[model samples]
Target chain A: MTWNSWFSHGAPTAGFTGGPSIVSRNNAVCNIYVRGGDNALWQKAFFNGAWHPWGRHNDGAVLASEPALGSMGPNHEHIFVRGTDGAVWSKAWNGAGGWSGWFSHAAPVAGLTGGPAIVSRNNTVCNIYVRGGDNALWQRAFFNGSWHPWGRHNDGAVLASEPALGSMGANHEHVFVRGTDGAVWSKAWNGAGGWSGWFSHGAPAGGMIGGPTIVSRNSGVCNIYVRGTDNALWQKAYFDGSWHAWGRHDDGAVLASEPALGSMGPSHEHVFVRGTDSAVWSKAWSLVPTVILHLKVLTNPTSFTVDQMVASMRDVYASRGINVAVGSRETLDLPLLTDVDVSTCIMGTTTAEQNQLFANRNGVGANHVVAYFVRSTNPPGNGCAAHPAGRPGCVVSSTSSSWTLGHEIGHVLGLPHVSPSDRLMMGNGTWNITNPPPDLIDTERATMDTSPLTVNI
Target chain B: MPVTMRDVRAVLDPDEVDYSAGARLGPEAFDYLLALVRDTDPGLAAKAAYLAGVIRGERSEEVVAAAAASEDALVRVAAASAAALLAPASASRVLNDLVVDQDSGVQKLALRSVPADPSPELRSRVREVSAGAAEPGLRAMADNVLRGLH
Candidate 1:
């Protein structure tokens, strides 16, 4: 629940001038780089349980600010820095080979204020951005084994601070910068669509200080965190086709540095910033619970189709903050099996003699909840769907509501009947679609989120 | 000293026993473990049956087979998984019954445990379930087993 801290040799002896940049290679090793007190780049390596001593890599160039870091391939890393000459310098570190001495780009940057923002689309191409002398953005890229000449992204807005970079997919990458107006403006590059004009994602309520930091949860969702006008931390997310309103998360602590974002796990985002106390601080944001349910039709249904049921179920659970993924439906050979107790419906088969009829079946994942929808129940009240606690699947009647599916599956997912008996888990053969029961309690939410079959996020 | 029912009970308590010591347990442990397959605590009985397979041998196989046939769903599920570790031909019959178990847990474990080289009879059973089982969970599992078997 707490971030583990490691103090490498040559840690910032002076206050960190700009945000330190770190990137993981092959997700197995993380290389961290910072501007040491002497104002040059110093780096350390973390891999296979041991940290290599900090080593300086800058080639006698006086760095004006922090360096940007990105990965090119398995164990390959690239670092970009703004030099005292106002020129952008670059270096590469290969796990197999050694360091590529700092090389100056063909064109010296005009204004070159802060560290450049750099990102790579896997091992194919790397893009770097820096503010130019005119206060506009300049960009260059490395592709097909060569560096392209720097060009202007001059979208008519002047940048006042450093830039942050993030890649949402193979073909998409975005750059965020603090505008002269203290607002955050973004311009994106789509592999097929080229560059887009700069757009505003809103700025801090107070004003902006340093650059913004961006991280992608997946190919479609990206979040940006920045220091607000009031020195508080603010965040906005680009998800589900539109940008979300900015949300504040300063927790009343003023920040002294730009934020850095990364994912510790699927759906888990951590934003790191420097508090006014000079100590590093982190806040984590987690996505909602996502689960997949596999339905097996054991009998022909007369009322509703399988897709209709799945859609209804998704809508019902989505309202409760749960993301439901219904797997493909498979038609089984027999009707739902009934137990000697008419109240309980058997899931797979009632007799051992029935085992031989189902050996070659496949497609069920370990985390999948298997539900068998049978025709009519013996005495059909709300139908007889039953499931044991902590099981992977359950049995439900075809005539049951989507709420019934949620209830029975909730039981398989480890939620017991709600004690008040007025909720969705209430087992009185009745449900209120419009009012429904309250959302799953915290403990139940945790159980559902941690279930092995659920998606990691 | 020979392992006793006390030792078996101790091992079944997750808090008290070291499960990783399953291989180090001696032959005497099997008899006691077999008796615990029907222990009053279904969870304990399930753990006992599973350990029987982990300490696998002549006696472990017998316990696994017997536990597979037990009426207790927990025991049956454990037995189904344990039986899969034994000689497929000898344990195939027990696995056949478990694959279609009324309990989803038992059915899942049984379907998962069916051997890659199951006997022809077991293969036939798997095919039947793959195509006819009322629950897609088992059917999906059956389909996976059939893919591997063929």
Candidate 2:
């Protein structure tokens, strides 16, 4: 979805200093917080389709840096900022009772310079990432019921700018930053796999002028924007699982500082920036196919375990509002089908060739899809999403990409190997594709959402 | 008997096993790595299988044999590497099983592990894998095995 033209919200702000922080408690209520010209927090509310007038917040909160906000859940809001005293502080709002007293989270041993970056996938977990005084990344978390002590990432990266944080699920987190070399870099945590080694995302042609800002449309997508060396907004996105090349926003909204992103769950998102005039401006956009797909899996065990692959598919699909559950897991027991050449299936031989596979495979037609786990598939694939006519399921290799399950199921729903190698239906060797949270493109999502197996929630 | 997570942890740290190569880790370490051939954690079990192959000592061939029988493809992949390192006579039995493995990766490595002067049966098996392997890389590797025939 393309962003709408920038909307200048002069809002009686004679001169806003930093990038604005914005979030939606739900789809209908948007709260945007910023540092007013008086070096204090200012907020404007958007509800029922109109943005309200700006007003002083936190009883004229004295701010030393930009304010960052996260929507824990509908009606639950949390905001964080670096105080003038060099300590990061936090406050909360629960839609009705007004703001809670500001709480200091203390500071990293090396202290910090940029506004604290924050993200939350649910109400119980929130993370605050900041650029330490040493230029390393420091983080503290609010988990379960209390705040945890500050910690530092051991990635050995020296940041040239602040960090941008995003979460795909409750346990997954992705953070991006501009390194001292002026190139964009990222690190990820997949809940089970832990933190990945830092990888480069390339640099804006004009070079990076500010820290990146990111927002996820769902579990399968991440959109990141940074102020470029060219003095305009540049963006790179991981959509439906594939990474898109970096490009400019083209809205002509030149930034005086970095940008901030906010969203109301999937489909609804906004980008706010401090324009050259020091006035807060924002552009909002929405995506399509806000629907849920359901598929139940039946496993046929092999020596290789299916837990990690199954769990990953569940999490990735869950983010896109798809529900996947294992129905009945049993062994295939038949050696012929268990270790057979699947060339005809992957390439579509004929009905008879397809019959060779589905003849003994059971657990069909329960308003969900089925997957047969086999020891292996000949012609060298970890899994085959291919089936003939009425089979409507996939045969998976015992040790395959966790995405192989989803990629194969995507076939039954009318998706093909139609996108990048990082996509769910990547045509090449999927086992080698290390990119996580694979993309399910808009067209593919629309197709999958309309399948007979999907019941809109 | 199946190896539990605790049982494996008691022997040696999983991460540290990768560094055990040529370290002459004592018998306890081999015992732990041996039992791990049946560990429920397939990924870790595969690593144990790899460690057993690279650090072939004190009945390590038994570890390689058990790994070949594992339903997990990764363990079998490690088994191929282990078998490749063993003396030709000792590695033949398991090498034959992996040569026909359903996973192309296992088949490719197993085919490459086949002794320079393969038995008539092994030569025929290499021909079969070269013909049926789905991946081009594996197919090419299998062909290389046939090319090296004396």
Candidate 3:
């Protein structure tokens, strides 16, 4: 079917290439930045029904990748794009203000290509991840009001597609990309450590032809989806540690567009992609019970004591028909660790402790469970030095608190950094602790549902 | 052993397999093969419908007919498109019923399968649906089909 309504921006192009990043904040607002006729970073934002003009970057020589957007705070959002100079730069708009002038960040190891992906864990804290010239994943985070060194970069063989990120825990995140071998690979970081070494899930049954998209329902669990060589949609998921087989769909059309996902409910997530005919098609499934419970923890690190944070997360989840529970740790009986899936835990921090607690409560059969600790470095009123870990402890400052949680949780799930300086989850831009873009939920959920889950042979 | 439907599903990547191998099974073999669409498993049914799209012959018509009338929207959409590829005439008739199908998804597939070149009657019918269809997706598709005819 003709999808005129869905063609919200950009006329058809000859190449399969278009803007790789499309994000919707609260579903009411969306920004899609593309490589324009001039090869500059061109953007269009959706407000009301119409798409705004093709806003070009005036200062940068040329954008090397797609622009990533995330809220800097309650009323402000930031856009990060890579320049031809191989340095990452940013611009912000805090509702009261329009797009601010561009600001540059310390360039990661040179030659960055592809648009960055940004996700705000909280208002002040964010991380940007990108693939360097070496085709290795590199990251820079906004911690204590400054950008950190691009974390130890590692290669994933060939990097033809951009990366996608998702929150894994309060201080953990995951990055996913298509390896040179055409298989999906992942790496993650916990608050107490740097990125873990790269790990290959397995080759997708079908040849992957496009970059993957990721979203996390909770820490340590995520689903990934990509277009196959035949132009059909293919998926692989990380649940309880092992990668599942690739699942294919017969949706009656070849999939040519990047898939977007949103939450249908707390236990349900859906993915949407443009068919070859340009029609938007979607598929959804209910997550298993253990997966649902685990996702809640990652999405809401403060689900126990932080009423405001929980409320905000709940509002976003509820808008998508997701059921969420917010209360204190004392009031709720957290599920035993063993009963949960633990295959995708990142090394370091309280992950071992949390996993141990879970296992003690459950049993060996609960090895599939994945658990993450929501510690903060900066407690209220503590200066940077007093902040836990000599940085802001997990609970230290509310600044990067939520955003960091979102970023870390992304790792526990299955996403990877999309841009080196984009956002924490995708490693493209700065982190803002506002509600995540609504489509982020959809993208993650859809990827998870469609991703291959290992079946007992 | 006969090529069971399970064998087809077990194929790591069907996109890499040669559709001509199935074609060698002949029309009757294909028809018997298409009957597998009625399998209870949604994944299996989905796979069968996908494979049916590659079969060529009159018996393929019967397979498409059965799939078109399926209760499953996924199967119906798949069947509608598969039918359009091989039997445009019969496909059009099936697509008409689907054009008004309850699910916006089915209607979408039906609109897509409708022949690009339509008889005047079909053109008029598409126009009517284009103007009256409630769902935005279906209305747009109907309008598009009618627009292409001119």
The best candidate in terms of TM-score: 1
Q: Encode model 2's per-residue lDDT on B16-84: one tens digit a residue.
A: 122243235534456777777788866456656655666656566788788889997767866776677
Can you write out model 1's per-residue Cα lDDT over A1-457, one digit (the tens) per residue? 2222322233544545555566666545656677766887776666886657667754786787677888877768887877776777888889768888889874434656656778886688988887776778888888888889888875687888767888887888888887777778888889789888888877756766676789885787888888877888788888889999888863675777787766634455666566665544555566556677777777533346667666665665666567887666787765224211122244433323123212213566666677666543322222333433333665454445556667767666656655444455653333433455435666777776666755644
State the lDDT at A444 in candidate 1.
72
Better model by DockQ: candidate 2 vs candidate 3: 2
Per-residue lDDT over B1-150 for candidate 3, one digit per residue giving the tens place of the 0 to 100 score: 565544454331121123445454444455444656676533234335545655666666667667777886656655655655656666666566666667555565567678876545556667777998877656877877877764
- Order of candidate numbers by lDDT, starting with the best: 2, 1, 3
Worst 10 residues of 3 chain A by lDDT: A378-387
Residue A202 of model 1 has an lDDT of 73
The parts of candidate 3 lying over 4 Å away from their true place are A1-17, A40-61, A72-74, A154-161, A217-221, A238-243, A257-457, B1-150
Listed per prediction, chain B TM-scores read 0.89, 0.77, 0.76
- Give per-residue CA lDDT, model 3, range A1-457, as digits (tens): 0011133233324222343445454435655555554656555565786557656656554656556666645467777877776788887877766768888875666556666666656566787877776676667888688877776364434565667777656677777787777777777777679668777765556577767777665555577877777777666766787667777655544666667554322344456565555333455555331222122232223223344443443444344343333211322233222111111122233343233333332221221212223211100110011111111112111222333333433333344444333233433222322335422455654433332221111
TM-score (C-alpha) between model 2 and the true structure: 0.48
User: How high is each candidate's TM-score?
Assistant: 0.49, 0.48, 0.41
lDDT per residue (tens digit) for residues B1-150 in model 1: 777776665555321123446546756788787777765644456667777777767787778877887876646766876676677775687787887677765676677778778878778888888999878767887898888884
